[model samples]
Target: MPPSADPTVSVTLAEIARIAGVGRAAVSNWRRRHDSFPAPVGGTDTSPQFALSQVEEWLRRQGKLDEVGSRERLWPEFEALGDRDAMGRAIAVAGARLARLTDKEAGPDDSAGWLPGGTDLSDAQRSLVERAVGLAKKHGARDTFDFLLGRWLDTHVRQINVTPSPLAALMAEVAELSRGGEAGDVGTVLDPACGTGGLLLAAARQWAGTADVPASGAPLRLLGQDVDATQAALAAVRLLLAGRSPERESAWGVDVRAGNTLRADPHPDVRADVVLCNPPFNERDWGYEELATDARWTYGLPPRTEPELAWTQHALSRLAPGGTAVLLLPPGVASRRAGRRVRAGLLRSGVLRAVVALPPGSAPPHSVALHLWVLRAPAEGGTDAGAGVLLVDAADVQQEPSGGTQRAGRAAIDWPLLHRRVVSAVQELRTIQTTQTGQAPQTAQTTPAAPAGNADGDRPADHAVVPVIDLLDEEVDLTPARHVPKKATSANLGLRRSWNRFGTLLHELRDLTATLSALELSGEEPAGQGTVTVGDLLRAGALTMRAGQQPADGVVRTGDAPDDAVRVLTVADVLAGGRSSGWLTAPDASAGENAGGLTLTAPGEVVVVGAHRAFGAWVETDAPTVLGSQLYALRADPALLDPWFLAGCLRAPANARQAGTHASTSSRIDVRRLQVLRLPLDEQRRYGEAFRRLTAFERSLREAGTIGGKLVDGLTDGIAAGRLPGNRP
Candidate 1:
């Protein structure tokens, strides 16, 4: 039976855009220009929600529901539950329903205890599950579940601490290369802190493509454990769906449990051939005191400040004899004083075979370049290869330019090139260890030679391999940049590029100054009517204000977002005079009834940031955006007030000081108290043009100053490094 109308189901503007196959701006325009559009049923003024039933009916009338399939229709209903745990339970129920299609004996409760009361589903939620099963019948279970899982992951990205696809693939590839054998050679793989089975899936894909199999044709074993029971259940269901696909010729032995691996390990007796992990970084309370006397600390007792070291040791302890484990850790663990002894012991024991430094933006906390440590369980009697460790510095490699209006300094990793470079370096080191094991070890006193260039000659060398002895100094520093030698040619080219950019910015600055000087102004003061307060204008229906409120922790995602996500404008963006640098997605925060809601600003709206040091007001000319905290969006009635003129009045120094609620510099401005001068529409336009021109001039000045600083820094560094011609410091 078709599900009846459920008024409780609600969706945000972003979700509406997805349903109608349109941009978020399109939905905002529909709300503004179409009188018949649905009014907000719930949510705050800043972010309003609409009933899903009404939105669907409206879309059907407009012929937009013709192409939206079952998957799209079911998502908003699942999200409307307004709780992540509830959403996860819905997914588990859906998975169980799909499983029944393959096995008549399997009941609705056959999710293997993935969710408590697994068979329990509300009528609305159960109806959504049936739609998911219908989607699976047509598109196959794997693809259907994958789409739902992908959306869920994207929504709760920060909380889950997902390992991005590129980095996961890179780690899997490195693990395969380290094995020095066929892809299917590894018998067992485990991820202790696995969140939604990203690494385990990567490992499965690595082995799935190969022709090799054991004599018995037994499937590879995949094991995982996570702290969150819901995530663990989702991970298990994800693996089951992937393994049960008809196209797959072989299956996998999947076992994912929920528990704190450091405190009470569920798989203490089992050792795996390969362990790939991106453990939680900077965790202070990871069973430090309880597990202090635990035997996993083979190298040394980990300090409280160095939780990554503890995870590193745990990964090592879980490896089978002659097995390999690859772990992603913060760069601080390589050289921090607290973990120095542990690092030295690993190097001396020869179990730490190599350390590869990945570029920033490869994973979470994108500001720091993370490192990958490759270790192998020792043979009996702890026989060391004594061939010195391989330190690969791939941090400075070329990167793909960041998409959207992200800041210029932020760039994404070129995954293919980086994977090839690091993998090839590791293979070369393995070859050396195999061929020269018995010979006396050679001491490497200085930085190793630069890597060889590619045969294509288009890409320069970016990684260097360093020896272990040189790394075991008084500080025992393992930072890749400290060991990798920079190419003189690259430095010179960078200096040349900076000089060219400096010249271009100077020309632009001159043009801006000329434009500002040419603007004519009256020499005498003109007569004006008394000013009107912003509150008065709002009460008179001449303007509408949406005050910015603090959003949920996961509302704003930094760095990159999905293609459908909208950019969020923050107070920092206003103060810096730049494009939006944050992202907004459809995720349910604690905003009840208005979960996943968003308010998008129009082109002519005024954006005001009232925080004392961050005070500023400007007319938004870019695409629609959600205002971040401390911001206010004012959309004026065009017939009454000009947006640019209103923005200028609010931004005046005296007006801001008068509106400030406190006598401190950091006090916030009460935007309602700000005054706007009363003027005729024609006269407002005249002043608006002047304000717009001055605003452009100030923005250009800031850009010019930034470029000038870059130019000076480049020149200074070039001279210091002796990269400039005929120059000495």
Candidate 2:
């Protein structure tokens, strides 16, 4: 008799395939070929379930177990625990055990018996607690718990809420920067809506070993409040693991309360030295009616849709004099009409300092890029504030490729570069502050160098110092792009470079046009060809279409690979003329694993964007890359179809229109329904060649236009600055 399957913890065949790092077809083949394969533990015929432990044993015997990580192995067990509330409770309990162990207040033999509330734990829950303890021992309590929480959030991302680590790091760094040169002077940090305590943990870590924070002295006071009791408990456990003693009384001030921060203020009168937060965005009913009369709204009352502005006010209200608060907010908050009045108020009072635009995929709800607002609590009589507001556009700062497999749609931040840029901008603001206060320059070059009689002077790349008076308008748009100064083109070398580039582009454009004309004149028009749907070609084995959604692990927005990771080709990359720019990284074997539902791109394959604004390109590069979200990879049989010809037909305007007819409200195209012109192989070769030339022509035209625009701007600036001779025939 074969081994019995464990009914408690089972996974579908698709999950098994994902675990084994193989295709679904391969898993199906394995089931049919191996008699020793795990039998169906549950589910219907179409979706058979196998015991997770049995599948692991089988995969281990076949040497495929190495593909699965410990986190991946634990996920099935976590899911088997049932619902979100149960999962949250189990996690909170496990966190309590880890916290006690970390604080040395519990013995090695201790269990969840010491957990607060004295909730009864089941056998399964106990097992989970033991596993959590093991993980904490191996990976440290903070990292282990953070990983668990991240995975839990990923499993039910729509329902379970938490801040991404990168964004949290950014907010923390901004808080530290807001402290000016005396960053070590910060003794207290607070997060009002501290979900999973990510922002608070980041703040604590930032101030851990500074000179001001003596090792023998009391720990820095960390305060947080959350609506969810379990999340608040988890936050407390996380803070305790970060060196705060459990026995430390409220007199020392380490509070992590479980309550609504908006309605009920835990530390209403206590002002923190630094407040770092990624507050909940786009909440409709955030107690607007009750909080309308609240004193926290020093700025104008935030409208119903602008709950983020209310959180902003709350953070500012909790800040000590001259203390800075960094908040991550949706970009819409910066320019929304409803929040315009509040924005103007913040600007006028010098409470709003800097707004940094981060790249997309920096945090969850990853579709749009978010903004970081650095605000400082104004001093008495507003004497310490600077006259100029600093705006840093570090949006383009990302990791560059370090020779590895790059994944598509993953936004990997270059932390070192970003840190330097943001810090430099803050230093500039500090310089402005010093200058405004009539203080002597500490350094000979303390003042920003400016051209004679030019208020819009030469500034650091991606940095702008906009006057506060200029920001007060009806729109009150605080977007960095609106304020940052353009690059100076007054130098002779700059003008010469622009001219050279324009000339080169013009030459290339002429050559491309000639080549296109020659190709068009040489090729004879073949007899009118019949049209065929892509579905017909797929059914006839002429092509195989594989469409993949964005991976669930995380979206990579940067185009740089760390080491052995593969570079991903995103839809943005495809639309940008199929260049390898803006590529993101994934592990080398991740393409094979398809762990995040990522599909690998192969040479000779034609890739198509299946979403709005349809586009297709042939995979000309041999470099390893994956098909990004809303993209389809079509591998054609060379004997039956030409790769270039297939790509050209798919990208043709006629076929695009046909595909658009089948599009849904979101304008997502079904590539299989696209109509393509069918012709003989010989005739297709001619048309394919012409299409290739046409692509080159279009690229050349774009290059020429870009160069021409730059040339005009350079000339205009040079003439205005009196650097270049303006006389012309």
**TM-score of every model?**
0.75, 0.72
**Each prediction's Cα lDDT score?**
0.74, 0.69
TM-score of 1: 0.75
Query: Residue by residue across 294-364, what tens digits does model 1's lDDT show?
Result: 99999999999999999889998999887888999999998899889999888878788878888877788
lDDT of 1 at 426: 75
Q: What is the per-residue lDDT of model 2 for residues 1-729, given as tens digits with 9 covering 90 to 100?
A: 222223579986666876777766678788889999989888755446789988988988888767324545665777788887567667767776776655463444345443333435677766776677766666666566777776676556556456766567767776776667464587889998887788887776677553223443555788888877667767776666555333432212357877778888877887988988888888887998888898888889989889999999999999988888998889999899999999988887778888888765566655566788999997766644465577777666665533222234333666656666566667676666666655432211223444476432133326676777777887889888777644443244455755766677677778877777664353654466578888999999998988755544444433323455555656766666554443343432353333335577778788877766645655445545666677888898888887778788888766666677444566767788876678878777777887777767676677667657867876777667555555654
Give the clashing residue pairs of candidate 1, or none: none
Model number with the top TM-score: 1
What is the number of backbone collisions in each predicted candidate, taken in the order shown? 0, 20
**Distance from true position, residue 27, model 1, in Å?**
10
